[model samples]
Target: MAAANHNTVKYGIIGVGMMGREHLINLYHLRGEGVAVVAIADPHIPSQQLALELAQSFNWPLKIFSGHQELLNSGLCDVVIVSTPNMTHYQVLMDIINHPKPHHVLVEKPLCTTVAHCKEVVNAARKRPDILVQVGLEYRYMPPVAKLFEIVKEGSLGQVKMVAIREHRFPFLVKVNNWNRFNENTGGTLVEKCCHFFDLMRLFVGANPVRVMASGAIDVNHKNEIYDGRVPDIIDNAYVIVEFENGSRGMLDLCMFAEGSKNEQEISVVGEIGKGEAFVPESIVRFGTRVAGRDAVQTLKADDDRIKYDGLHHGSSYLEHLNFLSAIRTKGEKAPAVDLQDGLISVAMGVAAQLSIEKGRFVTIEETMAEHKF
Candidate 1:
């Protein structure tokens, strides 16, 4: 196996959907890091063809499979990236964890559709210490976002008090089979789309979310679209307020119909002493102390020269793969930056927010976790 000697890491990507293909492209850019994508598994024929064309470009002869089990049974991968749909995460993750061979994993985010499933995967992974799994919460690796994290960690912001993230972007892209068109499959819009922001909020606050209060509905987008005789129930816009254990707060303002917006994501972290902000796509960050006043604010373009491919996610996906590869090559010396616990909490936060909107009140994370007796 490629990982046995830790010389070259071989990868297999399950569900070669949009995000999975992004992972493939990111790995392709990381070829200099001693990595190669050896295989891909996807039941959808069109997705397979698209990925095949990509692999052929890289001169990578791939072993394609119709299902994840076949990919696992083949023993062709040292690390497997699970970018399957939100609802399928648990089953695919369980199969990988239970398989005789311990293949390290980098599962795309939200972790699972529900808190119960996230906890199940977390517990299942806990039993396999030899296996390393990372959730693809790659937003943290975004240059501007990473710089903001640094500013906070360096105590320049001084005990962060609030984090407000606004993502005003286009609607979700069409996925294979249109599995993302409904709440049942995508875990609703908040859990499916806003998990990244929720994860970022937790990171900025440096604490787990205690409760979430949200207000949202299917205001626009996919109103007339019907798939399999059902209209899409996924919410298109929402305002979510999260309270962290540290008494700090986080807010997310999401809109799927705002294509005219200049910046897709605008994150502001305010501390007791100062404030810092990150703008995605613009890749800009601004910071200044309260005493320094507005005149003293410093702004800069954020860039990480290590990124060889700036894929769909503003180069964060490339950095994410690099970080995972380093952890795999280091054996037990390093751990995944985004562990299962991080994944679970992120999903839990999203779930709490979703439930909060449903119940029209604040939903506690404790109760959300207790759903499956976690």
Candidate 2:
């Protein structure tokens, strides 16, 4: 990667929602180090005003616009963070990739709503080799996950044989109730929420999933409607199976309406020599084997040292932003940690898992790609 051109790395945010607000705070810190957020655009006036207030607090001149096109055409930003809803990722990404600005794009998770749209954004990025397109799978940037990848690749765990994950949380009815309740906007429960876990599964195994099968039901949320000849269309609880190209297998259990259930985004990877588990929020990794081939498990503790940050998380959004900026300076020769292609595959896996559940059969990632005509 080329050296970061800090002075020239200006960013514009296209969405001012929750993730957008986080990015704005990240850019605020970046601005103190010569990089800046020059423009912001969102459909909601309240969002725009919030962004302006945040920017103004830093005494930075941030221009706010009503639409993304205005922000792009203003030439105030060299990169655009497309943090809009999943349905709009395709259009907004295409606009950024096609613009004369050819600005680098940092899109939020899952890339797009469907495989076809994922392909569209990726193909456009491929055509413009000068601009970089990165997907925000922030978990990949987390320190614990990074360490997990290193340990797996370093053979500390020996050949990873099986991976299992559980993500159970309360229904997401509090925010965007209608859009999330239905599959029309959210792209089914698995794709809407669990793509991040899918991405991590791929990353930990260091292989793409070749096949997937899943079973799920709207047992708690929207169950009555689904049983009454009305399709709830969204899954609330699911059991997913994934087989990797290298013969490793994974099982995932996801539930959205489990009573008294806490958010469980934990993964356990069983390997030939040992097993490893990651507790995401706590940033803890436990690895070790049983005593002398006994059935008991052990925990290999990490150093537990923390890295210093300049007003950013150790797994900082600003660091990811800096990485994107570096990729742009390198003219696509430098690989982004999470690129458009990775984003597509992540979404594809989610799509396949959902399809497997709905069709009551195994689904190949290839079949999902074929449906997209890719």
Candidate 3:
């Protein structure tokens, strides 16, 4: 991608929380390189102050607003990045989509809190093809994962057989100050966080998931472990198995309460000819033969060979902004860094997995769709 021409693709960020601030910093760097962030909005006063400070500190002429509606109504931004809460995405998106100026939207992962809202967004986006509504599924932009996709597509790993992704984090114990904790608001653990992996699985297999089987329980984490003086429904850890249409399969293991020992967010794929594995925390890619006669694994430091940026961290949110600018400048023809339907499908997979866990049976994608029709 060439340098983003400043004439098009003016950027703005909404909800300046952790992720939103990261976007602001990324956009500051982009501004130094010709791209501009003309405006920003967040309900929190502290967030607004931070945005103003960033604009002043970086010598950028950016407007700050207290709410997303005000930001959209200002007509200052050509493109908007919705970094609001999961439950708030649908309404904010609707507001932007309905605006006369019609700015393109780059929404955060999971797209929305429910499958119905996801479908609504997709339908609305379809009606107005001019307004590009992209969902932020950043893992697809990861260099090692991108390389893995290339290898799989080029037959370096012939016919992917299975993929296993393990995500072990400290806990969801942190006070989110929003709807991330409650399942009704954030759509539970899978939809809130692990949807990235679900989407990645679909992309890696290059096929849609046929069915999902899952088993989960709230084994640990939380002061009030019991719901209403009994047991809670949400699971702290779970294992989900996804069967794809291409006769391939994927497995996801999530543990939000793995105290002590090394933490990891790892993904490994096995194919007929060879295997490719990536450990996100370690930033390593291991590839080796999986044949019956020759089985070996050789690891390489993926960080060393990554596409370097000026001031952007390896796994930061900056890459997505760069990709977004590229997409806008290049129109829709270029390879989508992240698209809307992909995000919707990812959330659907999570919803299906949760349903499978509750029902103790395999659930199809279609069944999930029918269950939550928009």
Candidate 4:
């Protein structure tokens, strides 16, 4: 393992798609804070064009590679961000880990398309403790979500009993390659889109999921359209119930066709002594404790600036990159907010829910892990 540049942490980006470009923009904002974008890898022409344009606009010298291997071999960066398609995460990450020179990685959410691959990534990451492998579960860094976590940490929410997260949003946007429309590639809608909620549930409840029951179908999105004579098989709506090992439970109500809904996402948690709720797109949180009286409720709002990031997601995207760079600068002393194990468990919960939906029965996380058997 090589030491990081004392004054600057160089970064390499793999897959210059939508998420990749968002990271580039965020990195551009952090140029003065000891962060530098040194290299990018993506074979897509539009992605290449955007990367080149961004580099030129910043007036920073950058190396371009058609694939991740060339960037890794170049040894131009101390860290790498893997934002490739979900199915490609495992290979990209493993490559980073196996590189002759140590390279820390920040891989996008779900880790990979299956539980086994996630476990493999986790194990490989564990072997090299000097290298940092952070997952892009950016929701935890969102201001409102961070406030909710702060409330939970305050111990007012004693022995959390239940958590509910609802997302009523437009159907999945078409990706550069339409990779998101198929379960084989995206690891099902639950794993691809709902993993953030599941990760939050695990954090609030302080336990891993024990059992899951789910039901859903392709109610609207892609039902009337065919891609090369095949209707998309991804589900558009779902209700998932998860039981945690600590006796707490979680529920997720997802509707992909509800683009006109007033709130895009609402999350609520109830514990023995207090309760908290958050409306994501609105950037507001309402919380109350039994000690404060039955009818008392307090409202909190994230800073107005938190919603200003140039993307559909919250401003936490920039914060996530900031935290990752800070962690690298500290040489593993300042740990990532979301580490590899946290990423893997979140994916496990989603995979379990998807399996439960298919089998029409309660599926245990243990069962899913056992079946994968990595």
Candidate 5:
């Protein structure tokens, strides 16, 4: 492993697709903060073109590689971002951790498509405790979500009992190769998309999920579309309820076809002392105390310019990247904002919920984990 460079952190990216390009763009903006985009790897021409355009636009001296192995062999980066497809995460991450020279990794959400793969990645990461393996659960770093975390941590919302997250947005955007439209590749809608919400739920409730019950189906979008003579099997909507071990419960209401809804994403938490709600897209949060005569709603909005990057999916993504880079520069002294196990547990809830919906029974997280022999 290379010696820590406290002043600057070199970064390499694999699978320069949509999300990968977004990270590259963020890294470009973080150059002032000692972030350097040293290399990018992608097999797809379009992805490579976007990477090149970004490099040229930022005037970054970036090396382009046809494959991630080539970039890894170059030994030009201290931190690597694995923004590959959902199914490829395990293999890509394993390769990175097993490399002779260690590199800190920030992998996109769901970690991997299945429990077995997630465990494999986790075990591989454990072998090298010197390397920091952070998962991209960007929502927790979102301004409003961060504010909510503050409120909860301050005991303003004492004994949080329930969390409700609703995301009513357009159907899944077409991927570079349409790999996201299948359950096998993306781990279904819940794991692919809603893992962020699940991670938030766990954060707010402060406990692991014990039981999950869900109901959903592919009732909209892709109803008439077929690929290679096969219809898309991913669900378009779902209502999942999870009970945490602490007895706090969380609910998710998701609809993929409701694109122009009032709020793209909304989160509400109820606790013994107060109630807090957040509209993520609007960057607004409301809190009301339960004390008599002082029960009034207070509105808060994220006014930080740092979260306002152009073309990013969430304003917090920039912060997420910053957090990961800072962790790497600190030589794992500062833990990542989101650890590897948190990412795995979040996916476990999604997998359990999907199985519960399919089996028409309440599924325990233990059952889901055991089923996968995790």
Candidate 6:
């Protein structure tokens, strides 16, 4: 309700589902940082109950609301975490941006299901200087990934030429009403799940994408499981190729059925002088130059001592909250680590890749943005 201060920074969470609960717990761990989850809004009784139980464990007295508007009306929060379903992000974000009260936001990734909605959110947020909006592209905060970023920035991986990321993980979990099973809701597998990788690709290359080409389908998961007599159309696996404006290229190899893999994600960045690789779960980073050879490559375990909570995202979400809280306390002196443009471009890359798959051709980022009229 009041301005961001050194005092307790109150928070409200909309859509207390899986990711919403993650934010709740993250804020809980940051209680010593003057953070608290003061309120939560979720229409689903089950999700509400689960979040309430979590709040009770944290000894937080929450004012529960069935909808976000009610939570905003109560003036109980200085910041809000929007963890709603994908399709709903557009409207929920618009409402938050339009609300008179300033509520800094950390919306979960994808920004919105469509590029047009993301553009509108970007424009709307630009008007609200009082409100700081940070998209939850938490993968950037992962210890291993963050380490790779440092190496790249330090010029350890000189003149980056290619970046490749492989995610061999299980299928998407069942969300409220199984809404994630369709392309219309989740923005297809590329935008829905691979946006994280796309974001990482952009950072590793340090350039904007120029075009994308992809091939994927619903080949592995949710084939026989039908929801309301309609089978899922969302692709479960894909190989996406992104061409950047700097002539650096990126590739994504995704497989939802490879649950047997040791590491959930493995990323490699190859430049002119050296190459660096990071592995999630394994939490490892390796770097080597041509002169050093593969045998001489050094390996180290990636870890952030500042991370107090290691949640579902390998402590990235916790790290993200730490950064967001610091930025908030600065009172806009510091900007969000991942801004709206990063979110928009990540979605655009995914959208281009998705379109590429549908049309069986390379989709230029220019062409994709032109269609959105942004």
Best candidate, lDDT-wise? 6
lDDT of 2 at 170: 72
**lDDT score of residue 253 within candidate 5:** 99
What is the C-alpha lDDT profile of model 3 across 1-374, one tens digit per residue? 12245464577788877667767777776664457777888877877787788778878787878888888888878789898878889999988888887787889887997888888888888887677777888877665666667667888778888999998887764423644556776787888888989988998888999999999877776637544354334568999999999999999999988755363677888888888887765667777775633446676765433233423235535667767777776666664567878888998899988888888899898987774442
Winner of 1 and 5 under TM-score: 1
Q: Per-residue alpha-carbon lDDT of model 2 for 25-137, expressed as tens digits?
A: 87776654456778888888877788888888978788888899999898878778988877778888888888887677888887998998898788788788778778888
- How far residue 93's Cα lies from its native spot in candidate 1, in Å, is 0.5
**Number of clashes recorded per candidate:** 0, 1, 0, 0, 0, 0
Q: TM-scores across all candidates?
A: 0.98, 0.87, 0.89, 0.95, 0.96, 0.98
Give the alpha-carbon lDDT of every model. Answer: 0.91, 0.77, 0.77, 0.87, 0.87, 0.93
Once fitted onto the true fold, the runs of candidate 6 whose alpha carbons sit more than 4 angstroms away are 1-6, 372-374
Error of 2 at 11 (Å): 0.4
lDDT of 4 at 6: 55
Off by over 4 Å in 4: 1-6, 291-294, 304-310, 372-374
Task: Give the C-alpha miss distance for residue 357 in model 6, angstroms.
Answer: 0.6
Over the stretch 1-374, how does candidate 6's per-residue lDDT look in tens digits? 44446688899999999999999998999888888899999999999999999999999999999999999989889999999999999999999999999899999998998998998999999999999999999999999999999999999879999999999999999999999999999998899998899999999999999999999988879999899999999988889999999999999999999999999999999999999999999999999998889898999999999999999999999999999998998987999999999999999999999999989999999887774432
Q: Give the C-alpha lDDT of model 5.
A: 0.87
Q: Give the worst 10-residue stretch by lDDT in candidate 3.
A: 304-313
- Between candidates 3 and 4, name the one with more favorable lDDT: 4
Worst 10 residues of 2 by lDDT: 303-312
